[model samples]
Target: MKRLILVTLTLICAAFTLHAQDTTQQIVPGRVNSASNQTRPYVIMISIDGFRYDYAEKYHAENLLRLSGAGVRALAMQPAFPSLTFPNHYSIITGLYPAHHGLVDNTFYDRKRKETYRVGDTVTVPDGSWYGGTPLWVLAEKQKMVSASYFWVGSEAAIQNIRPTYYFKYHEKTSNDQRIQQVVNWLKMPEETRPHLITFYFPEVDHAGHSFGPESEQVRAAVLQVDSAIGKMADAVSKLNLPVSFVIVSDHGMTNVDTQHTLSLPDTSIVKALKVAPGGEKVLLYGNNEEEISTAYKFLKQNENHYTAYLKQETPVRWHYGQEDIYNRIGDIILVAEPGYAFSFSKRAMHVGHHGFDNNLTDMNAIFMAWGPAFKENTRIATFENVNVYPLVARILGLDITQPIDGKLEVLESILK
Candidate 1:
């Protein structure tokens, strides 16, 4: 009887070992069989702040080269305006335009709350009121698939009472290498509970680009540092033998604006004349009443050196910059600077780069690259939009988020196996 019991225990141990191995080897269903027909595979979407298309093509970075050379690259990703970080990033995750998402700008007065919402604040959490629409992470959770985020707008919000299984508090001190490691570790979790969708954000490059021009040495160095970190992440993914897809994207590109290109709205006498506050770049003229609104519009129109004025409803239909509900989000009059000219209200001398230009300008066109089993290799797709990202992400995790979305699930035909 003793011998039989020992033998039984040994057999059970063998079965358990086999089960563990099988779990580790699990891969999502779907293979890149055809260029025309491809489905979502497990996805890891990385957003490198202020990453421009030219930076990848011209800067000669190895990790970017691997992603572009091995995977599919979009020529440019045009971000939704005011071309600020929060609004565009929110659009990317929700697959909705900023007008629909309600994060219209990086900093805007929320009339309902009678307060200002800034992207840098961590106090806003798990509040569906502040974060409109369903973010990709929240959608992933409903389907019982795990998701994780290092730093992404609304990731900490705890929307719909759902949170990524693993999340870190927002921290400026977090190193790029550390953030990458966190993502890799999450991916390395046991298969049954491992995050199917992971989002990693790198902001140092963007910060450097804003402080220095996109082509400045500081920005280039930051880019290289981010590139090396990305290489480490790619290596980690490879080592794990995990079948993962990667979508590398940016919110907006950056451009140089010297004093020659500077336009001060307050100096133009627009704000004082109208008795209202001047909105920053991509000029917004805010006032309390119709009389003030009319005055702001007249002031903008009179000053031809700095801006091209438009009524909130009449701002260019093609840019999709205007929506009925978005009236409160925008200023009374919209001011778009002429090419190379940046709008500012400060009198302390103008400096640095800006991205709130028309989308046609290359400076406003961001970067996008994707790789792995779900993508078609070495092919470029021009019809891509930032809003299209969420649908592809949703399909990867098998999340049934049936909410209406602006982005369509057009198969990325370039990165297929």
Candidate 2:
């Protein structure tokens, strides 16, 4: 009994230490804005995770509505296919489809590396080697323009051997006020050192949507909470007299799935012959070889009910997955659930809200709003792909795109002043 208690205490202390590390700020030394870059405009890119395209209006997020109305708003922003959190957020920043960026899913198995990259895993989440593409911060730092991140996907990793000059490991314990003040403090730094590009993220809406479903009062409350915080942050930043632009976006939108009847694998006979990675809206199955994969694929298609089975090479072209997979991370077979259904093995109740669906669905669209000095007044635009945001931010901060990316600048160029 004493030994068990001691072990339990040790595990608790270890977990607490990890969380503490997440809260502390991480600053890379020996980086500063160049003399030329010091005069460049500033942009604060904010991502509200799982904020649906219509959330601001549906929930009456007055502050967001007001701010977006004054500058630029999109009818909606289309997330890349497999509209999951990590993939789409990375897609927004890198201007690459998930397959192009190599973060093809929130959790994907890389056959080449013989490893699985799962979100929220302490070891893999911060490992730079798993990531590809030059993130905005990496681009800025390469050009002697400093950048910072309050919280954003890939911000914690040192992609291309560079992390933002100022960043924090993600931890949800920090209050809204503290996060806002931290941004204000960073902006007030000397011009030579202040980050010209800042990335901020909010996870409240996503949390609420998952726990209580998109239509619940809890989601409304979360939307209001984020709206209130943004209003405060923008009001405080405006007082600084700096030319700042605010681009609000979400990684993906939420949908309420049919919870009463969750979708399960149609065939269990071949389970022993395959490896499986299960996501809420999709499942990936890997087989030992072509014959094994073919057999499993045939079996799944015959027994298909709520889900559709596709061989990896035959996934929708728009998803940029399957044959476009550069890292060979996609499984041999993928099972995508129908919109109203979710894939699960547990008999227990599934989460009512879910994403990770086909991005072309209207319900999967996310929000996009740009305001402040960088945007035209009272401008509203049509739906645009989220990938284009990378070039838009690059244009605002005067950074050049160093490599080939899927996003084209012309798609969103009209919104700028």
TM-score of each: 0.83, 0.95
| Per-model CA lDDT versus the true structure | 0.67, 0.86
lDDT of 2 by residue, 1-417 (tens): 000001111111111123234588899998989999999999999999999999999999999999999999999999998888888889999999988898887777888887877776677778889888889999999999999999888888889889999999878788999999999999999999999999999988887887788999999999999999999999999999999999999988889999888887754667557877777788878888899889889989998888999999999887889989888888789999889898875555677888888888888999999998989999989998999999999999999999999999999999898
Which ten contiguous residues of candidate 2 have the minimum total lDDT?
1-10
Prediction RMSDs, each to the true structure: 14.8, 5.0
On the 0 to 100 scale, the lDDT of residue 78 in model 1 is: 79
| Runs in model 2 lying further than 4 Å from the true structure | 1-21
Q: In angstroms, give how far residue 283 of model 1 lies from its true place.
A: 3.0
